[model samples]
Target: MSTTYEFQAETKRMLQLMINSIYTNREIFLRELISNASDAIDKLRFAALTETNLVPEDANYEIFLVPDQKNKALTISDNGIGMTQEELIANIGTIAKSGTKEFIDKLQNHEHLNATELIGQFGVGFYSAFMVADKITLLTKKAGTDLAFKWESTGDGKYNIEPASKESCGTTITLHLKEEHTLDSNNEQNYLNQQTLQTLVKKYSDYIRFPIKMLFDIPVQESDSVETKQELKILNSMAPLWTKNKNDIKPDEYNQLYKHLFLDWQDPLDVIHTRAEGVFEYITLLYIPEHAPYDFYQKEHTTGIKLYSKNVFIMDDCRELLPEYLRFVKGIIDTPDVSLNISREILQQNQTLKKIGKNLEKTILKNLEVMLKNSRDKYLKFFKEFGKAIKHGIYADYSSHEKLRELLLFPSSRSVTEDSLITLAEYVANMKPEQDVIYYATGKDRQAIDSLPQIEVLKEKGLEILYFLDRVDEFAIDMLAEYAGKKFQSISRGQLDLSKFETEQDKASQDKLINENKDLLEAIKNALTEKVDEVRISNRLKSSPVCLISSDSGISISMEQILADVQDSKIKATKILELNPNHEIFKTLKRTFEVDAQSEQFVDYCKLLYGQATLLEGLTVENPVDFAKLIAKLMK
Candidate 1:
């Protein structure tokens, strides 16, 4: 006897939504149905462990894809624990009522069932088939039961169930595909095509523990005649490399897996595998690529990690699994704890994923630290490729600065080679006995920074000066502020305290020289009134005659350069002109001012000195032609 039933009010509304708009891609319908089939098989296996009479010990468990092009029907068949009439009504007739969830709860205390890999969390997955099919027919016979049942639904807010005949225990779902015109008008997927089915199976269900099989026509060449024979081929690999123990897997296998997953030709720089249990169970197989991808810095680039649940692929680029700073990492994260909505395509906002992200960040950082402590060369290689990204993390995430600080590397004045990089800890450890601050200089590169006049005094005192070459370096360090109790100071910015290096007589001479040249300095400052904030005698410029510096409070000169490079940035750094008292040019300036304070020659001398300071600061000399003419006049 057949009985037709009307769906509950809420169920009817949800069924229509699931059929028409719940899933973004119609192709996901197959993934959902296949996941449900896998779950049914898992239930049967788990039940068989306690009840031996449910099925034979040697029963073959698999899911088959059979597509009929002429009839426009696609069938997904699985030999597992099938549902009875009551079970069918409870699981299918009701929306959001998860049979898999109920089964797991019922067997919560059963230790063997805990190991069972069930993929379905929400019963709504079964309804996703309506997206591709005009109607669905399900036939099933529960194991150890003689009676069978058939459930049919057009997804028109109702379904029918009846007792049926079957040879054995299992479940088979046949989808009557929509008409060609209907499919085209609705933009529905055509699953009757064998190639499309195979591709979808490989992409979404390749790691199912049970084999997913499909019949393929094999071409045979026999005695100058070609014929095709049908053969059942396993479509999925069935073994996820990450699911296996690390000790059991070889290094080459991990590299090959990385290459296969990321499509990178080179081996990964590092591989991290972690399994967390107890409160939340999950497994992560992460890879650090040998080099950044071409689109790594582009807005269109997606986060690298893919997310899965119970080895079933969910999303290709799960951004929530990693923070923006670690977007370059590529890997897969699989966990059953995630609360997937009805579609099972996206993650719901929850603390589980966030906690997992925090754990992953710690793991990746620990791996990097190990590489840094034990394998300096390899760590440096990674730093050269990805250090810029890690530095940005310090700027973007203040809480992570202390952890990310040890991973930072910079070139110093004492670095013997072009590639030699020292850490902030190393710089602090090697500080001069009298040094109270960490000194750094910013420029386009090491050579430019080394030539800075302000660095000469620090070098003379045997103090190391870090070279901030990257555009973001200064910004990141500015956020860093202080490291290991030492405040970061830009050598080219503000005044330098070199009193410890100066004798009383040297300080007296500096004071006397500045006192005597006060008029010359004031005259020069007045000549270029708008260009500089102040004119002062410099203790930072040891051998160089002049240089440009920024005030201690405002934006630094390096930051000004960076900001200027950005379009429509009108901000500028406050520039100060500093002159060395011991340099011979200071005497020339003093003599020129004493000879004729209002003379064009003295004004020209001031202009030349300002031009010189500007050039030394890695800035263009404004009015270059006029400055050149002045230089020529001075030569005469």
Candidate 2:
């Protein structure tokens, strides 16, 4: 007997929305149907373990794709568990009704069922096929049953179910595709093309446990003529390396997988394979490349981990899986705990994804910590290529500064070679008993920073100074503020309090010298009022006559330069001039001050000293030609 039924009012509304708007991409239709077929097979495998007679002991299981160009139809057939007449109406007649979900609920001991292998959580996946097809016909027979049935629907809120005949216990769905999808074209959109079917199966269902096979026409050359031969080929690999036991995987296999997946010829610097179970089960296989990609720093470069749900590829670049700081990381994350809407095109912003991201971040950081502890050389090499990106994390978020602080490395005054870098903890550990602050200097490079006059006093006192050479080094350090109870002090930006090394007599002598040369210092300050904030006697400079330093609360020279370059704005730092009191230039200024305090010669001497100070601090003079002329006049 044939029966006709009208879909529920809500089912009609949802079906229209799904067919017209829910799915954003048409290619996703094939993935949905294939996932449904895979789930059907998984259900049968679970049922056969309890009911031995449900299926033959050595039954061959697979999903097949057949395209008929003449009929303008594509058929997806699977020899798995099928539904009876009542089961068909109950599962397919209603929207959002999942047979797999009900099957899992009925099991007394859920452990007996391998739920991870089942892909269909919501029954709506079957409707996705309607996106490409105008009508669908389904023929099915339940396992261990002789009765068969056929269900037909045009997706217009009506369907027909009737008794049918079949020789095997399985389900086959044929899609009467729309004209646009079936039209012959050179593009891959043609639904009846074998190449198009193979591509879609490999992209979204390559890791399905049961083989997904398709028939292809291959040309054969006989003795006198060429003939076409039809052969069946398995499209999916059916095995994901990350799903297997990590112990069984070899090191060479990991290297090859990384190279093939990422198209990188070189072996990775390291590989991290993690499996988490219990509350939420997931597997992560990550790789740290030996070197960064050519476009790693380009603005258009995209990055994220490949996301999979139940061995089915969900998204190629799932940005939610990793933070921007870890963008250099490349890998895949497969989990069955996430919630997907009807289209399966977007992942909801749920707690499951957030927890997985947090876990992955912690795992990567822990792996780096281990590498740093056990493999110093390898860690340093990795740092050299990606250290700037790591430093960005500290500046962008204060909460991560402490976590990433220990992993930071910088070259210091005590470094024996270029590659010898010290951590903040190491610098703090080796601090002198009298040292109360962490001192650092910034310049264009190590050599420029090494020659700065402000750090001369620290070197004389046997204190180590960290060299901030990278453009972001100063900004990142400023964000850190302090480490190990020692506040960061920029050597070239503020006053150097070497009072711990000064004696009572030395203090008194410095005060007397400043008072005696008070007139000379004021004359110099008045001359360069626009260029400097103040002129003072220096206890910091040893071999140099004068240098420029920023006020304690003002921006450092390096930071000012970086901001100007990045923003293209004219922002200047508050400059303070420090004159070495014991240098010969001081004696010459004092002598001239007594002779004629307001003379042009005295003013000229002040300008010359300021120009020289600018050059010593790695800055350009306002007028190099004038500076040279003044120098020549003074020499004559």
Candidate 3:
């Protein structure tokens, strides 16, 4: 006897939303149905572990699909835990218990939703079958129960459940494909053809935990007779890569598996397979690619890892497995503890997964550290591609800043001896006993920072300053305030208090020169009102006449320019001009200013000094073309 049931208001709304909207692509129906089948098999397996008699001796755990063009029916059967009459009504006939209300509400609001996005949230994936079929009929029998039941729905707010006769201890879902969806032209039949359905099954359900099989026509030759058609079987590979042992898998096998999973042609630079078995049991296969993908920096890019529960595919591109900063990593993480029907909202509350994620992040960072030590060349190559990401990590968290700082590499001034990039540890090792700080300067290139007049002062004090050419280097150093008890200092900022390296006589001579340039410095400072914060004679310059420096608390001019260019903000800080006392131009200026302190030529000389200082320090002059004319007039 068949009993028709009307859906609840929310259920009716959800059914309409799902049928008319929820799934953007109709082909996802196959994945949803196959996922339901896999879950059934998993339930059966779990039940059999405790109740042995419930499983049949010859019951092979597999899903089979039969396409009947003659009857217009596509039947998908799975030897898994089947539903009873009550379960059929509860699971299929009504969506009252399913969380589809929330899903429908979200979809109605035009929120982003995908098939996998709603999988664990609501146990109503069976409804996805309606996207492709006009009618769905489910024949099921509980494993130990003799009675069977049939649940049928037309995806129009009503369903029917009835007693049925079946000998199998599983479920069979037959989808009557709509007329437009039917593979054949015959109006009498209601199903997809064998070839079309098999292609759909393979494309969408290839990764289902349980074996998915389809019967195909193949040529067979009997003794003295040629048979044109015979039944042949195909089983999609359903064992996920993370389920395998690390030692049992080869490098090529892992690479090929990644290629198959992501359809990415480039090989991964490294693969980390780890199995954890303590408070939480999990298997993870993480991969680091040789180069970042085009969408690596995009906020919409998938997180690149699939999350699984109990060897069954749960979700693809599970963002909970990694933080946003580490989204470039690609891999699969399988944990039996995760709920099979977990929702995106539930993932946020999953403390165990959060802990697992934190541990996995630490493991990856430690592994990278090991690689950096053991394989320097390979690590350098990796840094060349992903080093900016590492720096980004340093800037992301304060707790991991020290560790990320140690992982950073920079060109050293002393590395003039070699082209090798030095780490913070190496920089600390080479630091002079009295030198209590690590100095670094950032610019467009190593040669640019090396040739800057600011470095001459640090070199005169016998300090080894690191040359930072990469844009990330400045941000990274800022995040890494200090290393190994030494503070990091930017040498282009303010006056260098080199009291540790100066003798009494050197200090006396510096004081004498400062006194002599006091009048000329004051005049120069007055000539450039808003430009120069202060004017002073430098004991640091050897070849260059002058250089520009920012305040001690301020960022360097180079860093300022970088920030300005990146953010497109107006330059807010002015620079101090420090003139060389021994240079000819400075001495001539001192003599001229001493004779006629407010003369026009003296003012022109001060402007030239300020413009030259800006030029020497890698900054643009206020007016480049006017500055050029001034230099020409001065030459004449």
Candidate 4:
């Protein structure tokens, strides 16, 4: 007996919306169905661990698809754990109404719901078949059960359930392909034929563990006659390349796997295959791309490694496996120890899953260290593309700070070209015997920071200075206050206390310049007032008369600019104005200040000097018009 039942109202709304527009490409329906079939097989495999009889020893488990072009019907069958009559009602007869309602709420909330992401995240992936089919018929019989069921629906808010029979326990899904999805020369994409179906399985489900077989009629050309004969073909790769041993795998095989996973024409930069056993068993196959995707850093771009549990594809791009900073790393991870039946939420919080993530993080960093030491030419090429994002990991991953620091590539005062990068270890090794602090300067780029007044002083002292150009460089290094026992000192942020390196006579001469300029410094500080934190004689300037430096407790100039660029609501830092007492302009200013202590010329000179110093710090002169007038008056 068959009875027509009305669908839960919310299910109908979600189904309608998804069928019409949720999945951008109708062909994704095949991928979703294939994934469901694969999951069913995984569930049964896990169950048989306790019940040996659940899976017959001789029974071969797999997926089979048969397309009837003449009847415009497509059938996809899988011999796995089938659903009981009651289970069918709970799983398919009605999708969880609450899930549908939440989807609607998120839709109205204008979340970033990419159509590709929606196809499988929700429980309604089976309904995606409706995109290419007007009606669907399902036949399923639970394993070790005598009864079978047939569920039919046109997806018009009503479905029919009746007792049915199957030769074996499993599920068979028949789709009545719509007019557009049938055979036609005008239709570029049709699902009613063998060729299109084979292509889709290879494209999306090739990584599926089970052998997906398709049966179709092939034209037999004999010398005397031409006839059609049915033939079976395996449509999917039974064992994905990631499951194999890294030592046994060849370069070409790794490249082929890269193409299969990403569908990219170019090969990967390199591939790392890591398998962890013991407490947390998992396999990580990561590929370094030859080039980044176009929208890799875009706000809406999706990136993460494909996730699998017990050889079953769970989801693509599971962000929980890696920090957001390492979004560029792409590949897959398979963990049999993790449960396949758990929700993505539970998987995220699972202790075993987290342990697998930490192990992967360490392994990736270790792999990078080897590449940098042995294959710098290629590593440098890769760093040129994704080095900034890798540094972002240093600032974000609190637990893996030291490991991330090892992979950083930096430009230094001794660097000749843009690609010349040195590690902190390398920089420290090259440091002057008297130098104990890692001196660095942050700016927009190598050229901009190269011209900084502080850099000139370091150049004169024969000290190496690291150039931090990226916006995130300061934050990442700030988190790591020191590296290899040497503390980081920003040349533009704090005082240059190289007194230990200076000879006693040199120190006395430097102190003499500061004492002689003491009176002028006091007058200049009063003149500038709140515009600067303090006015002092410079020990870190040469050609430039005045230079700006941040207080030791405050932020660097580059950091301040970053906060400003981001439009942060926090208060900005005030700069310390340091005057080069040795410069001719300051010597002339001191003479003029002594002559007329209250003259407007003296005040104009102080403001003009402040404007010049602010410009050197990579900040704009607040009042350009007034500064121009002051300069014009001084020139006259």
- Which one wins on lDDT? 2
lDDT of 1 at 604: 84
Q: Which pairs clash in the backbone of model 2?
A: none
Predicted candidate 1 versus true structure: per-residue lDDT over 537-579, tens digit per residue: 9989878999999998889987887788875577888989999
Worst 10 residues of 2 by lDDT: 113-122
lDDT of 4: 0.80
Model 4: residues with Cα > 4 Å off, grouped in runs = 1-205, 210-213, 218-226, 247-252, 259-265, 292-303, 315-320, 323-325, 500-503
Weakest 10 consecutive residues of candidate 4 by summed lDDT: 114-123
Candidate 2 or 1, higher lDDT? 2
Task: Write one digit per residue (lDDT tens) for candidate 2, span 1-636.
Answer: 989988766666556655655333576578777877876886676567557898888998899999988898999989889999988887788754333334334222342432111212223567767778999999999988999999999999999999999888889999999898888755577888888888888766775678998889999998999999999999988788799889998887677566445645467899999999999899999999888765677665567477777775556677777777788898989899864221223464666887999999999999998998899999998998888888888888888886799889999999999899988989999998988899999888889988888788889889899998888888999999999999999888777787888899988998898898787788889989899988999988898999999987868777777888899868888889999988898888878888998888888899999998899888889899999999999888
Per-residue alpha-carbon lDDT of candidate 4 for residues 365-469, written as tens digits (9 for 90 to 100):
777789999999999988888887888777877776766788888999899888799999999899888788999988888878988887787888899999898
Could you tell me the TM-score of candidate 2? 0.65
By TM-score, the better pick of 1 and 3 is: 3
Cα lDDT tens digits for candidate 3, 1-636: 999988777877877776676454465566667777877887786677557899865667889888776666778888899988878766776666534566677668863466544542344667767766878898999998899988888888888888899987889999887665675444222236556656666555555666788877676888998777847566566767567777877677687666445545457888999999989999899888877754565555677787767776566767776766677788889898887656657876798888999889888888889988999987877777777778788877777785577788887887754347888899999888999989988778777888888688778767888888777677777777788889887777767777788899989999998886677788899999988788887755778898888777666677678879889868665578888777898879878888898888998898888888787777788899999999899899
Cα RMSD of all models vs. native, in order, equals 14.7, 15.4, 11.3, 8.1
By lDDT, the better pick of 1 and 3 is 1
Give each model a TM-score: 0.66, 0.65, 0.67, 0.70
Model 3 residue runs over 4 Å out of place are 1-223, 226-229, 298-302, 416-419, 457-462
